[model samples]
Target: MIRHIVFFRARDRADVGRVLEGLSILKTIPHSSRLEVTLNGKVDQLGNDVDVVVYGEFTDAAALAAYKAHPTYQESIDRVRPLRDVRMAADYEVTVD
Candidate 1:
């Protein structure tokens, strides 16, 4: 299994909802097994302006790649591109769970 995690820091925190909605579109997709959207909470430890965290799970790398190239994702990019400041992601194979 592959776990794809993404952190999005937006220029405006209010724009998080639009971005989250865009991500929700992928939940109904056939190849996507699991999708989660989280609103980052105010924590003193991490001062990052990251407002949203997206976690996606796929059976394999191919499935992850397909999710990235999906039209729904492209639409998301288009929607959030204007309000985004920076975005970072990491993907790793799940060994324990």
Candidate 2:
């Protein structure tokens, strides 16, 4: 199994809602086994907010890849493109549970 994690920072606070909606679209992909989206609940000491986080679980790297190239994701990229400031992604194979 592969776990793909992502974190995004928006240029402004108004972008948060649209980003969350875009993250939710991942669940629509056929290969997506599990999907979780969370808003950053705490503010940093520097007064910066984390914005959003997405955790997606798939059967393998190919499945994860399919999810990334899926049309829903493409549409999401279009919707959030203007608002996105910084984005980060990481993928890992499940070692134990």
Candidate 3:
């Protein structure tokens, strides 16, 4: 299993909603065991710049690759890129006994 995590910072705080909405399109891509888009809920934190987070769980590397290549996912990326200032991603394999 692979856990894919992405953190995004919007160009403007008001654009966060649009970014989240665009990212939701990833849910339609196949081979995703679980997918979620969430807003960062930081309270009174200093230097917290992340505005949104995308969490995805895939069966393996192939599934993750497929998800990234899907047209719908590409569309979402195109739409959200303009609204975001920064994006970071991480992928890790999870072992289940």
Best by TM-score: 3
lDDT of 2 by residue, 57-78 (tens): 8998899888888898899788
TM-scores for every predicted model? 0.85, 0.85, 0.93
Q: Residue 56 deviation, candidate 3, in Å?
A: 0.6
Model 2, CA-based lDDT: 0.83
The reply for model 2, stretches above 4 Å from the true place, is 43-49
Q: How does each model score on lDDT? A: 0.80, 0.83, 0.91
Q: Residues 5-91, candidate 3: write the lDDT tens digits.
A: 999999999999999999988888877999998988866458678888899999999999999988998899899999999999999
| Model 1: per-residue Cα lDDT over 2-69, one tens digit each | 99888887777777788777666767666768888787775858585677888888999899888888
List per-candidate RMSD values in Å: 1.8, 2.0, 1.3
Backbone collision count in every prediction? 0, 0, 0
Q: After superposition, how far is residue 75 of candidate 2 from its true place, in Å?
A: 0.5
Report the C-alpha displacement of residue 83, candidate 3, in angstroms.
0.6
